[model samples]
Target: MFAPIRWLILALQFATILPTPSVRTATERDIRCSVVWFPVIGMLLGVLLWVFQSFFVHHMPSLAASVVSLSIYTLATGALHLDGLMDTADAMGSRRPREAALEIMKDSRVGAMGVVVCLFAILGKWSAIASISPDHWEPFVVVPMMSRLGMIWSMVVAPSARSQGLGALFARKIPRWTVAVATCLCGAVCGLVLPFQQCLWVLLYAILTVTLFTGWMVHRFGGTTGDTYGALNEIMEWVGWYVFLCASA
Candidate 1:
């Protein structure tokens, strides 16, 4: 029996630092099926972030609170996505041929471009969080949730750049219908927290951002990899925050 709960647990364990009950056995199918639960994990993360931001904003200065909250956010995910972003940046920055660039990405050392982009991403998130009005809790929840949904979209639609690695397995194994299921679930949650029109717009932007980014990656690397998926998540999160900010304004 392929229990949905078990898949959800797999997703949580794969995507976050949060502890979960161990699943004694897991198959490639189980890992692939877990993609459906990614948005749910993002929603949970958003809830935690919203709650943390609400608490910290009252006790500390907005800038300081933003730093602390961002730190917690990064720590919670074990900086998994950020690591991907850096590796992707390093690969792209090399501007080498496709194979060489991928080699660069696989390298363990962080390059200069990687460090710079990482700093920018963190600073951008911090500034955006600090700027968001404490009364507006929607961005916190919507951004993270939508970003994870973006990952599913990328994995489902984009071919893997290589024959091996987690990205290839997910790309090869994920069911197409999972896209609709994940999108609807994410949409329903967004609708609950955001105005209908705004939710629709945010979803629209998410689709555009993910599609365009995936296309760009394909153009560069012949397809996407695990690093690209992480890179997309980080990029989409920033885009989501900005979209929400503009929508609220």
Candidate 2:
């Protein structure tokens, strides 16, 4: 087995745009093995956001802090999930035959639907973050973790929409054992950072959101794709934010 730190580095390297230890010769198996560390990446991201919030929340208005925080979020991950969201939106909005819709998603150019989705997603998250009370900031840490867990769940439950690409690698290579272990780890992390009731609720929400979205992807394109996986992560974050909002309310 790859050392735990190696796996974690790989996960961090893949999930974020941050500089990390080189793995120039990393194989598909190495990447597959890294799947288990995905939640750790999320937790790392949450902690960074938490620290950013600490600095910003004390100095700036909530709305400004929220915008800056969201910008940090985009930079940290290179807006990888947001790109997925946009591509998926473009594909879904095409309303063409399955192949044609997939073609639209594969195109490098963003479509009108993609623009609309990105606009609203950013606006919605900014609004939610700004509105949330500081006392409930713990949910901020848990939300990112839940969203990464959502990505794993999507890979576990859905076939790849295409024969090649990141989605296929994950769908085919990630074992059921990894998913099981990851779930336990995520549960542990959530339990540590959130109330038992809220942790359970977010867990349920992540599962249902991933399952439902993957099912829709299957119905539309015969399976999931890298783009859809990204979309799933983005949507799950939104779900987390809204759930946190409602819970805090």
Candidate 3:
């Protein structure tokens, strides 16, 4: 229990831009152990976004408030997942051999596809937020948590694309029990934090969306990578928001 507590802190450190003491000697195994807390970090992010929206929505136009909320979300995650989404887009758009696609993803320079997808992701999110009433902000809290759960699901269902790196570490290490616990945590948290039907709606769609994404990724790359995990999070986030908007309506 104590060890997992430490791992949870480590997970928070890796997953967010929140201030955390540097873990200079943390091992790969430690990083793998942190998988259990991935959704926990997402939950925290959701809470923060909800609080931000709550504080600002009453003061500004919904679109403006939505943009501000999205900006805060970007900063909090250090744009890490967005970067992955772009890179994955570039790779997928290249439609080259797996090795070549991987190489494109490794490139630091953003390509046209990367730029377009990044724009789509941010703009789509902005529009989704704008579409909903500010009073219905519970979806903001639920979506991030569901998206992070998508990441964990991808890790469990797919093998690593590369021989080494964070993807490999997570692929080789996430325990089945950890995935189970994370799933249960997600359900419990959603049930408590959101309307019951909306909660189920989010979870069901999140899982199915991720399942389709995982299948496509596996077919394309023969496995998953860190970038795809991030991509999954981004895609699932949009899905969650859209689902919430529809369900709440």
Output the number of the lDDT-best candidate. 1
> What value does the lDDT take at residue 105 in candidate 3?
88
User: Tens-digit lDDT track for model 3 on 61-138?
Assistant: 878887888799789999999999999999999999999998898788899999999999999999997787757667
Pick out the ten consecutive residues of candidate 2 with the lowest summed lDDT. Answer: 1-10
Ordering by TM-score: 1, 2, 3
Off by over 4 Å in 2: none
For model 2, give the RMSD to the true fold.
Answer: 1.5
lDDT of 2 by residue, 67-158 (tens): 88879977999898899999999999999999999999999899999999999989988888788766666777788887888888888878
lDDT of 1: 0.88
- Total backbone collisions for each predicted model: 0, 1, 0
Which lDDT tens digits does candidate 1 get at residues 1-249? 457888998998989999999999998888888899888888888878877888899999999998888899889999999999999999999999999999999888999999999999998888888889778887887889889999998888888999999778987569877778999888888778878899788978998999899999999998999999999999999888878778778
TM-score of each: 0.97, 0.95, 0.94
The residue pairs that clash in candidate 1, if any, are none
Candidate 3 worst ten-residue window by lDDT: 21-30
Whole-model Cα lDDT of every candidate shown, in order: 0.88, 0.85, 0.85
Task: Give the better candidate number (1 or 2) by TM-score.
Answer: 1
Instruction: Please report the candidate that would top TM-score against the real structure.
Output: 1
